[model samples]
Target: MKAHPFLLHKWQHWLALGFGSGLAPKAPGTFGTLAALPLVWLLALISPLWAGVAIVAAALLGVYLCEVVSRDIGAEDHGAIVFDEIVGFAITLWAVPFNLQNVLLAFVLFRLLDILKPWPIRWFDRNLHGGLGVMMDDIVAGVLACLLLHSVWLPLQL
Candidate 1:
């Protein structure tokens, strides 16, 4: 089915929009990240291993979600398709043990890497296409955040 903007009735469109969090007119990505928090917190509570699993699952699901939503909306990587952001933030917090301080720091770090799109992140965003393209840059940002988080924490542990 060749869907369009008028098809707001579809579940895929809503899912793509991060269930309307991404519909925010200003800083939609920030809202999308905020929408990811509860899920992140819940998964984090289940233990670090489960949180990692959930992130992986969400990312795999995100590939399909982006593909479907972008196709349905007649665009690729639409601003409103933020399941990638959700998954990315989840990745940022993986294995961190999820205290409020850690999660907030991850949020800030992920947003910075994501918005700045440094290095390979920018390359992936500019060069890739389709659903995987939509997800790859954010995944890189999450990885960057993870590394930064660990670097800081490890020094403190030393």
Candidate 2:
């Protein structure tokens, strides 16, 4: 695979690279998602609504950033472009309490659902193109991960 020529100075590229976490030579998506954990935890300190807003903003801005980066890189959803993963992780943790266990679970579940892309997630990933396509599949995965965490473990804790 040809390496993307990521200009370090550009803000959009910086975001597309997940603030440098997405620059990892391998598994950039995983690193991007991992980097989102702290921000999610910090946002968890605020209202969940605020976190939701932030995630929404990320998704919305990600469209332009992803599109620009993909075009620059000459590939669609290139591994180095990981803003979607970062935003997806944030969406996965929305409304969930700030706890180590929940964070870890969200990480695992989000990554799995994202990588596996079952059902609509898979459909969206395959059918969608450009920025919306890059972000939508991960959005679906994030929602499913959030739902799984809430449904499977909320009852256990209560």
How high is each candidate's TM-score? 0.91, 0.93
Q: Which structure among the candidates has the greatest TM-score? A: 2
Instruction: Give stretches of model 2 more than 4 Å off.
Output: 1-3
Model 2 scores worst on lDDT over the 10 consecutive residues at 1-10
Stretches > 4 Å off in candidate 1: 1-6
Compared with the true structure, all predictions reach lDDT values of 0.84, 0.88
Error of 1 at 91 (Å): 0.4
Consecutive 10-residue window with the lowest summed lDDT within model 1? 1-10
Choose the strongest candidate by lDDT. Answer: 2
TM-score of 2: 0.93
lDDT of 1 at 77: 90
lDDT of 1 by residue, 1-158 (tens): 43336256777677778888987877878888889988887887787777788788888888888888888767899787888898888888777767878888999999999999999899999998888999999999999899999888768877
